[model samples]
Target chain A: AQSVAQPEDQVNVAEGNPLTVKCTYSVSGNPYLFWYVQYPNRGLQFLLKYITGDNLVKGSYGFEAEFNKSQTSFHLKKPSALVSDSALYFCAPPSNDYKLSFGAGTTVTVRA
Target chain B: EADIYQTPRYLVIGTGKKITLECSQTMGHDKMYWYQQDPGMELHLIHYSYGVNSTEKGDLSSESTVSRIRTEHFPLTLESARPSHTSQYLCASSEVYSSGGAETQYFGPGTRLLVL
Candidate 1:
């Protein structure tokens, strides 16, 4: 079964500081990874995805992720954290055969 | 801009009530999916459709049923609502490009349901 794992439940960072949210996955074949953010009372907004080619993928809101094949990890990163960036983040792995499997999620708190 | 829309942005209903959540997309995507999510929690796929008149259950077991009568419309119905069904339901659509799973999904605002 294809699954995704987000190790941290929450990550706290000060405004203007760099931030990182870790993610790993287990799949039988090629993996299709994605990052999504959900604001309060809203649906998830797609941030980025890694299908093939580039190992380092850039996304919306100045977010980026690095796909490591050997470690099976695709961690999201940002050069500088902003207060507006505080939200719930989810890492998902596409099953293609059925649906996408999401991680438990990680809450990012950007304190100003 | 092209988008997916879900109706009844917020709903609080009593148990045993039959309710249908409507989902429509204008992106002309062939695949659509329904997901259930609790507050500040992970998203679990409840159902999905490949195209019109095609539907399949997802990883999560759900009492709600869905139908895809039109290419751009997929509606989910709950025969009898329960307290456990109180959660946010998200509707998404994607255009499957190749068999390698390179499709990107576009989501709607979602419907928040509260079964009292």
Candidate 2:
């Protein structure tokens, strides 16, 4: 089963500062990558996805992820983060048959 | 926001009680999924359905069972709830392409279950 790995358990960033959350996946051909965010007491929301072409995939809330095939990485980045961006983020790659294998998640805390 | 919906956004129940988590989507998506997630943790897929009457177990070994009798509804049931079963249940739906691959999944407000 293919899976994604998030090296960071938590990330702290000052509001208005740049933020990045890193993820790597176990490779299996051309993979589809996804990023989802979960706010407190809510379900996971779709952030963005990478299927093919364009290495830089942009998604909701001013977030973008760079897909690096050589590094097997998909890193989510934001030029400036807001306090409202504090949430749990997940990087996922679909396993065979289209089931998502999610990473252990990274909690982003943007403080003022 | 996705049209997917989950009922009883929060539930607190006693051990041994039977509980059902209801999920419905207005998107008419062919692929639906149920995932178990602890607070601020990773998501574990428990069940998924390709379409009506096509339920499949996911990588996680869950005590809960799900049924897909209709394209719009997929409900998960725990015959006897336990403290271990206390967690958030998320419902998601996605459209299937011609190649049988799925696109991005849209989720509903998860149902949080607490069994004491």
Candidate 3:
């Protein structure tokens, strides 16, 4: 069984500042990791994924994630935050059988 | 536009009432899934279908039942609604890759249900 953890419940950052949302995972085999974002009252939208080869993956809305094997972490990062970037983010690990095990989610609030 | 749609964006019903949540995709994807989520919580997959008539239960134990009668439709039904079942239901669909590897899922707008 695979599991994911997002240590932060909420991350607040000033607009134009760099931001990071932490995520870690435990899986049996090679891991397939994903990042998703949800706006208020909406379903999750895929942001990025790390399947293999690349350690740093870039995604939509100028978001990126770094996959660190040694730390067992895949933290989401953005060079500069925007107020429009405020949303709930989730990190997920792929199940052996193609399902996804999601983290508890982290809400990002970009203050102006 | 290719899209996945979930009907009854907001539903409020009494406990013990039977209800069905409708989901459909026009993307011609062969895989469909249903997930339950509470506000500010993780998503739990309740059911999934690989294709028409191939529904399967997911990791989470759910009281709801689902069916895939058509390639584009997957509907979830609850025989008896309860307060515990009050949550946002998300519908998603994905195209299966021949390589037997990872695939990205496209999600609908989601349906919010409240059981009174």
Candidate 4:
């Protein structure tokens, strides 16, 4: 079974500052990872995914993640933060069999 | 943006009442999934369908039943709603690309159900 862990429950950052949310995974085969964001009372919105490619994968909204095979991590990052970026973010690892294994999720607060 | 949609954005129903949550996708995806989400917890998969006439239960033990009569439609039904069943139900869909083994899922706004 593929599983993902997000250590932080919440992260607070000032607007225009860089922000990062940590994620780690355990999978048997080649791991496929994804990042999603959810606003209050809304379904998750797809941000980006890493299928197989460069260690660095860029995603929507000027966000990017670094895939470190050795560490089994795919951390989401943004160069600068916007107050609107505040939301719940989830890190997911694919089952490869089509099922989605998601992390508990981390709440991000970008203060103005 | 993702073309998936879920009806009854918010519903308040009493216990023992029968309710159906509708999910539809305009992207013509081959896979559709239903998930139950609670506050401060990870989303739990409740049901999924590979295609029309195919449905499977997910990891979570859910009393709700689902049917996939058409590729675009996958609706979930609860015979008897309960307070325990009060949660947000999310619908998502993805296309299986022959070459790419990883399928990216697109989600709908979700249906929030409150069973009183």
The i-RMS of every model, in angstroms, reads 1.9, 1.5, 1.9, 1.7
TM-score of each: 0.94, 0.95, 0.93, 0.96
Model 1, runs deviating above 4 Å? A96-98
- List model 1 lDDT by residue over B1-116, tens digit each: 23999999999999999999999999889999999998888888999999999999998999999999998999999999999999999999999786546677888999999999
- Report per-candidate DockQ: 0.64, 0.70, 0.62, 0.70
lDDT of 1: 0.90
lDDT tens digits, residues A31-73, model 4? Answer: 8889999988789998988888798999999999999989999
lDDT of 2 by residue, A1-112 (tens): 4678999999999999999999988876777889999998888899999888899999999999999988999999999999999999999888778777776799999999
Q: Looking at model 4 chain A, report the run of 10 residues with the lowest lDDT sum.
A: A94-103
- CAPRI accuracy category, model 3: medium
Worst 10 residues of 2 chain B by lDDT: B96-105
Candidates ranked by TM-score:
4, 2, 1, 3
Query: What order do you get sorting by DockQ, best first?
Result: 2, 4, 1, 3
lDDT of each: 0.90, 0.90, 0.90, 0.91
lDDT, candidate 1, residue B45? 93
True contacts kept of each: 0.68, 0.70, 0.68, 0.70
The local lDDT score (0 to 100) that residue A55 gets in candidate 4 is 89
